[model samples]
Target: MLQNFLVPDVLTHNYLVNGFCKSGDLETAKWIIIDMLCRGPSPNCATYNTLMVGYCASNDLDKALDLLSTMSTCAIRPNRVTCNILVHALCNKGLLGEATKLLGEILEDKPESKTANLITSTILMNGYFKNGDISSALAIWEEISKGHRTRDVVAYNVMIHGAGLSLHHSLAYRFVCEMYKKGLMPDVFTYNALLSLLFKEKKTTEACYIHGVMSKMGVPPNIISYRVLIQGLCINGDVDLAKEYLHIMLEDSVLPDIYIWNSLIDGYGRHGDVQQAFYIRDQMVASGIFPNIFTYNALINAIAREGKLVEAHNLKTEMIFHGVYPDVVTYNILIGAACRLRHVHIGLLLHDEMLKKGCHPDIITYTQLLKGFCLIGKVINAEILFDQMISSGLMIDHVPFQIIIKKHWRMGELDKAFENYQIWLRRDK
Candidate 1:
């Protein structure tokens, strides 16, 4: 196409650049933009805005800012769209201060750009919520309510989800009620967000009440709603009620996904009911639902907790046979189990397996292994692993370092213990 055309129009260039950006080929997109500029086709506000949006979408904030500056130099004034894109990118990166500053500048320039106002306000409010500044979020909400005649459902949903994540479930419920007063019906997302909070707080009775209210209001419960409710019940150790909900979901023809099964299995495992948990797993397999990593982890950890090493080891073998590769969490559980059973050789073997699978052990994994070594009086091995962790660029935080230091101290290795203490102090400073 380029060979036939002596020069491409600005619209054609904009379209191609946007296509590249959307496909995440930012370098190619930039090349196309440069080609357009070299061809002497004057770039307009829309062209600059499109490029800025692309940069923001790609999370190239620095490049986006540079483009913003270039836009001004090119004498193509940025539109509301451009400002909103920048604000959104800043918020997404957790640069709330910068986002707020850009927003202030935009509002100061054009107080009546309601489109920019709405978009920026939503981004800023969400950023505040994410930063755990509920006071700031509420203030922004009040500002929006005062300015706009009607708030969008998205704004309300963000507030609800943010509140829930922050453990202010009651405030989230109040937002729902407020939405009701404004004649804005709660959608599936709204219910899901509130239900997730209820579950997080273990407010089973309130969750059930919400379920009833949802049914009474003729709001159809989606798969997410059911999943959240079931998971919540499971997390609260109400496995019987979780099972009841599972049955209800099956009867309602809402297919139980892997996550739901994992939650149920994890719940049962937490309650030390390995048999019931395996029963659920069997049902899952019978229903043709393939078990994922979480499934195997739950079962392995549960059986290991019961001192059923043979059964747990068999499950690990079955997991590999099924091609569901274990993750770091799985290795941690296996190592912990082996440690509890005094099977140091087996634990070390699992550690080697983790390395063979190219799965790097995280701090928790190392911590568990360290405890295992300490328990078995293998201080030298623990020290070696600790050094390996540091050499691998893992941060030697105070807790784990202190644990190793104390262990060495107890063993009368004063020099090594003091050296570790000095390292911790240096890092702390």
Candidate 2:
């Protein structure tokens, strides 16, 4: 095929480039593109776009940008696909300023090309939301919404998901209504965003109503649809309802993944039904799904909070035996449990174990240890741990200082209390 200068050869080579890039063989993909450039059947925008996508996917943004310049040198104008791929790649790196500028450049350069305007704007709007720039996201949405060519279902979906992330329940609903007004039916994603938003707001009733409406409208709920509901219901203390949905999800032929299984296990365990949590774990294994670190963490957290350290430790051993090693969250839970149960020795030992496991102690781990030491009148140990926190580069927060100050004050050490308070004030300021 390469020996022949056929018209479809370029497309065949482009497909090969895509395959190599997807498989993380950027070198071979770039080689093919270079070969196409040197030989007959010269690479076009599609060819360059494919290679640029591969570079972007590999986080070689610099290489991707360099290829854009090469596209210009080769007399190939960047099309909508090219502009979108680059804009999205820039956005991914949190370069909103650069991304926005690039977007404007692309849109301005191709005044006749209206196809990419909506897609790029949607990408930019989503970037803003991800970076916690709600105002900028809304500003982009407002600009695009005013443009008939740019206002589409995908743009609406971005707005809906952004609203959920921002917890703007009314805003999401407004967008949903606006979609209807524009003759754009709300999609599965729209309802899922609403489900996520309502759950975050603890508006369980509204979330359920939205789920029901999704069914009524004949928009089949996918796996995400069920996962969001189960997780939210479990979090909001409606384990029973979540369990009911799990059965319904299976009935509807929507397969439950590890996440759904974890949610159920955690929910039941949190509701003080450890037996049922274990039952779910057994069922998960029987269904050929092995537990991950999260599965163990959820189970450990449930029993550890109930002062069942022995059982939690046994599970920890079980997880280690099964090669599901403890992460920071795992140790944090065990330490918190030990502190609350007045087992400061166990807390200290666990802290050491976390280091041995090559897991750095976070602010939470330090705070829990500080509390444990302070509670036991180990003021000197607490002070040493506080210094370690600073040395370890953990973000110092109000809680740790408060714990130390209260401890000193309780022990009638006015000078020490005032000294720590001054340090806290200085750091905070």
Candidate 3:
């Protein structure tokens, strides 16, 4: 097509450029832009912005910024879209300082620039909250509230969500009240945020009240809403109440997903009601929601926690029958259980099985196995496992160090124990 079309217009060039950019072929996209410049219809600002966005998406932010400079040199004035692409990329990468500087520069250049609009402000505020700079996030919102940027429902949601995430439940509630004063209705996201905060704070009555308000407000509860409530109730050790919500969801024709079932199963399993957990799993299967790795893992973890190693292992076979192979988490739960039961032999067997099944152990796997060895008074074996963990490019935490220290002290090796304790102290620093 390129051979037949002698002179491709700017639009055609941009079309090809966008295709390459979206496909993550930034190098090819750049070459095409250069080819367009060498040919006719020199690239425009949109052309440059497309390539810049591509660069940012590829995580080559430095190159993207350089392209922005090139745009200025070529007398192609960048618009708000160009600024937002860079700001969002920086914010997403957790480079909040750089993002703030860039945003300030864009606002100075174009005060009316939509680049400093609600979306970008929300992004900046979210970055601040995530970085533990809540004061900065509140300051940004103060500016928005003062009419620097048009305050919208989404902007309110961001602040509310951020407050909840930062563990400021009272502030989150205040924000919701403020939203009502501003004549803005809270959406499902807003409720989810508040509900999650309330649940975490053990304000179950308040969370349930908000759920009632949601129904009154005509914002039909979503699957996420149900999931959050169920999980929260389960977390508070109210599996029976959580199961009631599940029944209500079913009555409302809201088909529950695997996660919903898994939460209840885990709740019941953790409460030492293995029968109830299995009943939930049976209900899940009846609902045509096939148990996945997560379902079986929950069951295995629950049974393992109850010191039912044989039952947990039996569930592993059942999991395989359902075509779900054991992952590292499954083995870790079993290994931890075996250690707690003083069955180090079974834990070692599971470790070898994980290796034979091509499932590499992670840090938790090594840590659990080390603890098992240490608990069994096999300090030499624990040391070997610890060394192997470090050689595999994994860092050792104080848990392993403490195990070694305690074991040494028990064996009356005072010097060795003190030496390991010093090493642990330095590592902590």
Candidate 4:
């Protein structure tokens, strides 16, 4: 344990940096690296890479990139791992140009990194797709395929998944066939991508067919696979089929997570099946998956729409009892319902409670409350609320003006009503 007798290895020092960075202690992580430089166990590429990753994780990407200069000062050349990490972080931040430039610099410095280039290219392609530049992503794919490097399933997956997300059916299918032609087997990701695309296209028949194909081809669907299947089906208004897939998922030994349950509950609620929504909530709890705010929101929305305000209020109270405190969405739904029913006092109380709980009210929240107060002839309260909305810098259209003018007109204040009418007319124009 004597520091002088046995200095920590480079791996141990890197671990300390990783631990500190993960805990949001970048200062300590940097101090550890400085200590290594001042004392023994000279830092290596991995050590600086660890520190760079920490900087990136902490959102100080400039400092992370600066570590490259420090690495050079220490006479350590940054390797492909370092390049890939920075490239990935850059892509995630939507800095595609910067990422591309950095990748070029790395490849120019060391041109023998075929495998590393392929992986980084996939990340860049994905980044392009996310930024909605499908052509750029395809251009990246073309480069990879044209190169001598053998295209792996992962590269193909990135292309196919990108195409799927962008709803490019032709590209997704073309990639699937290309994978086969190149003698690369499609993994679970490949099929999942296809299924997702089919759902977006509303080709439910093809999606189901692909699910069957996955089973026959022995590409076992993971939790994400089933989730996409059920979620897409539920979204396309096939809650019944989605429920069937849930049973199939359990049979496949994939435990349904909270997301899956919430999707099903929301789907049934949307389908106007209040009892079924609650039934799903109970089943979710019975499976040892606690119902989250989303679960209760769907349930509350379903019944609240049916004029069952009491039941909806009780459910809101129950959310707190179960430790799922009401969020902005929760209050919004209740407040909107109360306004609809002309129960403006209930909406007011909910608004106050929302603020006390530190849930910031959005424009929708302010708009709803403003309409409620105006409807109940509380013009002073309505005006005060409107000032608060303007102070909050909320952007909205003429809807607020429409409410103000109508309220003033009903109160027989034609001059005030006419003034707002002019402003609304000019603003709308």
Candidate 2 regions exceeding 4 Å error are: 1-8, 145-147, 390-392
**Deviation of model 1 at 338, angstroms:** 2.2
lDDT of 4: 0.87
Ranking by lDDT: 2, 4, 3, 1
Candidate number that wins on lDDT, 2 or 3: 2
Minimal lDDT window, size 10, model 4: 387-396
Weakest ten-residue segment in model 2 by summed lDDT: 1-10
Query: What are the TM-scores, per candidate, against the unseen true structure?
Result: 0.77, 0.93, 0.79, 0.85
In candidate 1, stretches whose alpha carbon ends up further than 4 angstroms from where it belongs are: 1-15, 38-44, 112-115, 145-149, 215-218, 247-257, 273-290, 352-429
Best by TM-score: 2
Tell me the tens digit of each residue's lDDT in model 3 across 1-429. Answer: 568976778999999899999998888999998887677588899999899888888889899999988888878887777777888888888999898887677657736644357677888888888877889999988877675465777888888888888888789889889899989988999888888888999989888889878988988788999999999999998899999999999998999988899999999998999999999999998999999998899999989988888988999998898799999999999989998887888888999999999998888888888888888788899878876775787767777887878888999999989987886787678
Q: How well does model 2 score by local distance difference test?
A: 0.88
Better model by lDDT: candidate 1 vs candidate 3: 3
What RMSD value applies to candidate 4? 3.7
Give the per-residue lDDT of model 2 (tens digit) for 98-207.
Answer: 89988888757837656678889889999998898989999887776576574888889998898878877688889889899989988898888878988998988888
Report the C-alpha lDDT of model 1 over 128-172, residue by residue, as the tens digit: 888888888888889877876358777899999988877787888
What's the candidate order when arranged by decreasing TM-score?
Answer: 2, 4, 3, 1
The Cα local distance difference test for each model comes to: 0.84, 0.88, 0.86, 0.87
Better-scoring candidate (TM-score), 1 or 3: 3
Best-fitting candidate, scored by lDDT? 2
